[model samples]
Target: MRFRKTGAPISFIIPSGNLGNGVAALWTKKMGLPIQQVHFAHNANHAVVDYLNSGDYEPSDTISTLANAMDVGAPSNVERLKALYPDFSLLKRDVAATSVNDASIQNAIRKSEKHWGQIICPHTATAATVREQIGESTNEWVLVSTAHPAKFETIVEPLIGKPVEVPAPLKAILLNPSQSQNISPNLLELLDALSGPKV
Candidate 1:
């Protein structure tokens, strides 16, 4: 989580799920950069469309794509992001947003496998689409690989036409004993846990 900028505009694209909120918070805390959280109405096709059409931010020609996890229609942490960076106008000037569709994602997977021989998960594919949109002349742009590709073995295997190998560390998660604790999605319930006595 080192926040090194290679003198290029940085944009963080997050999936619309529980994890997206945490990712935004971590980046805001770690990088101390203003984040533009893309919020999609549940029925909206593209989360970044309105933001782009407003003429507030210029869109990049190079957009990126990721698979299943990238299927986020509405991100939940946009207000947190704005609050973290009060100087919103300056922040909007440097950062832009876009999302890749399923078709584009599959094409990207085929293209990358053909060109680089590397298999990236759908989320990574989304980031790659953005990077490519930015063009080759841009500096080092980092894409967050949220999880291992092996997690989606069935889909990825068919795309690459081979079995994907699981990293040694991740293999442990598959082997080890684990437990799950279910919690209600209500904010008040979550707050009660935080306000409760230490475990």
Candidate 2:
């Protein structure tokens, strides 16, 4: 709301596994913004696209894919999305949902690195696909980079044929002082851990 006065274009191209981001986008439109569109770029698991296209909106079993973040089949945010776009007709008009499978996601990631010199994560790759389809336009597009490609080295490195260097910050976090205790599968073990070390 604070940025409303700035008169910024509110077009968002977000990668969604579920409809949480989708709901937020719709909310912007409801709150009154010069929103050109709310484009949802989903991964192989594409319940969001199906819901937006048809009123089916049925949740299904999760299909694992490279874009693990978007691996949700039964999106928990459907109710919230429905609440924002009560009218199915209006929802379709404001939102553009498209699904990209494993093959496409691979291509996107490869193309991104080869052409754009960017090592984008799988989730961001989905958004890039839709952005290309939409083409260059006056509307500003905000591509949400949910995670760093370095995290998914197993998937990305083999495809891109290059090692994704772990970010220094991530390395530091991993190297930070850590503590853990082996315990039985019981609440007592958890409670004991929370109480601090044995003296």
Candidate 3:
């Protein structure tokens, strides 16, 4: 909201899942910036396999993959998205929804490492795949790298054929976190917290 208020064009590219949808509404309604929602072909686990086989194989209709963070079978954000963008054509013009399988994501990771020598997490890999599919346009596209590669070192290291380095900021978390909360994946519970009385 602040970004849009400051006259900056904000574009949010999100994975296909309820998580992405929740915030997307707030941004569009409150900020009036464009939002592009992208759907990944593979779930968390099989993202690598899907990316590897992307060229010849079509995206699977079944929603199964490894990347657990993004394993959303039915994204609940669709209604809000429709409400936000009433004109379908305009939505299509400004907002884009592309599906990139796991193969493409892995390819992007490898390419980014080989070409740019940067280690990006799976979320960033998905963003890169979408950016490539969108082609090079005059629009200044900024991809939000959601997490540090080290977050998924187990999956990323072997693929890159090297150990991924942890950024200085994230190293602290790796060292020791005070506590972690395990909450039920219930939207109502989340909304209740968000809508609770202000302190």
Which candidate leads in lDDT?
A: 2
Greater TM-score among 2 and 3 belongs to 2
Tens digit of per-residue lDDT, candidate 1, span 138-175: 33344555667788777677888889899998888889
Per-candidate TM-score against the hidden true structure:
0.62, 0.83, 0.63
RMSD of each: 7.5, 3.0, 8.4
lDDT of each: 0.53, 0.84, 0.58
* Residue runs of model 3 more than 4 Å from their true location after superposition: 1-12, 19-62, 175-199
Ranking by lDDT: 2, 3, 1
128 Cα displacement, candidate 3 (Å): 0.3
Ranking by TM-score: 2, 3, 1
**In terms of lDDT, which candidate is stronger, 2 or 3?**
2
